[model samples]
Target: MRTTFDFSPLFRSSIGFDRMLNALETASRIETVDNWPPYDIAKTSEDDYRISMAVAGFAQDELDITQEQNMLMVSGQKAGEDKGEYLHRGIAGRAFQRRFELADHVKVVGASLVNGLLTIDLKREIPEEMKPRRIEIAADKAMPKGATKKIEGEKHAA
Candidate 1:
C-alpha cells in the first residue's frame, strides 16, 4: 500500500523550509522501503546521540560517512572479490546507503567501526549567542532624571 500527501499548500506560506518539506514529500512517496543492514539510534545524553549500523563484511575503507547541513549519509560498498564456492549465502554482503535527518546545531563528533558494527556519534552544540540569556533590569537608571520632579505651579497636598 502507498500513501501520498500534497504539501504544495504549505510551501506557499512557509519560508526557508524547502528542505524539510521536500524530505516529507519524498518519504511519503517511497513505496518500497529498504531496511537492509539493520541499524539502531540511541540518545546517550541530553545533547548526544549515537547511530549504530550492522555492516558486516564491509571494511572501514569501503564505508563513507558524510554530513551536509541537516542530513547525514552513510554508505557502504564491499570491495570486489571472488566468490569461488558457496553452498548457502545467508549473510548480507551488499552495498547500502542510509540517511538520517538531524536537527539544527546537531553535528557529527566521531565515528568508529568495530566488530562489524559502524557507530556514529553526534552532539548538539548550541552557540553562545543563541543560548538562553538572563537580562538584568535597571532599577534606577531606567527612570528619567525629571520623572519624579513635582510641577513648579503644583501645590503639595501633604
Candidate 2:
C-alpha cells in the first residue's frame, strides 16, 4: 500500500521545521531486517526522556552511543571468540545499528549499561528566555488617568 503525506500546508504556515513529522514518515517507510534489537522509549518528565535497548549478550565495551547532527545512534558488536566451538547458536550476538531522530535542542545526558539493559537518558534544555513567563500588569499601569505621560497605544485619534 502506498501512503501519501501533504506537507504543503504546514510549509505555508509558521510552524517552523517539521522534524517530528519527517521522523514519522521515515519510520513508517523503514524496512525491517533480521537484526532488529528490542528497545523501548519512555518519557520520564516534561523535558526528560529515556531510551533502553535489550542487549542481553552484548558487553558494555561492545556497545556505543553517539549523537551526530541531531541523530542518536546506538550500535553494538560482540567480539568473535576463537577458542569456543558453537554446538548450537540460538542467541544472536551479532552487531546491530539503530538510529533515532532527535528534535532540536535535545541533548543526550548520559548512557549506562545495567542488568543486561543499555539505558540512555536525554534532556531538553530550554533557556529561561524561551520558557513561558507571565507578564504582570500593575494596577496603576492599567489606569490611563492620572499618569505622568500618555502611553503609545493609550492615545486614540479623534
Cα-based TM-score, every candidate = 0.84, 0.73
Candidate 2 has its poorest 10 consecutive residues by lDDT at: 141-150
Please report how far candidate 2 places residue 70 from its true position, in Å.
2.2
Candidate 2 structure quality by residue, lDDT tens digits, 1-158: 66767665766773756776677667667665544689899999999999998899888889889899799999998877646789998777878999888887899999999988999999999888988999997675365667676457666789
* Top of the candidates by lDDT: 1
Candidate 1: Cα lDDT at 30 = 77
Question: For residues 1-158, could you state the per-residue lDDT of candidate 1 as single tens digits?
Answer: 55579999999999999988998998888777799889999999999999999998899999999999999999998889656698888888888999899999999999999999999999999999999999998776566766785567867898
Full-model lDDT for every candidate: 0.92, 0.84
For model 1, what is the alpha-carbon lDDT of residue 63? 98
Model 1 regions more than 4 Å off: 141-147, 150-158
- The collision pairs in model 2 are none
Q: What is the lDDT of residue 81 in candidate 2?
A: 60
Candidate 2: lDDT over CA atoms?
0.84
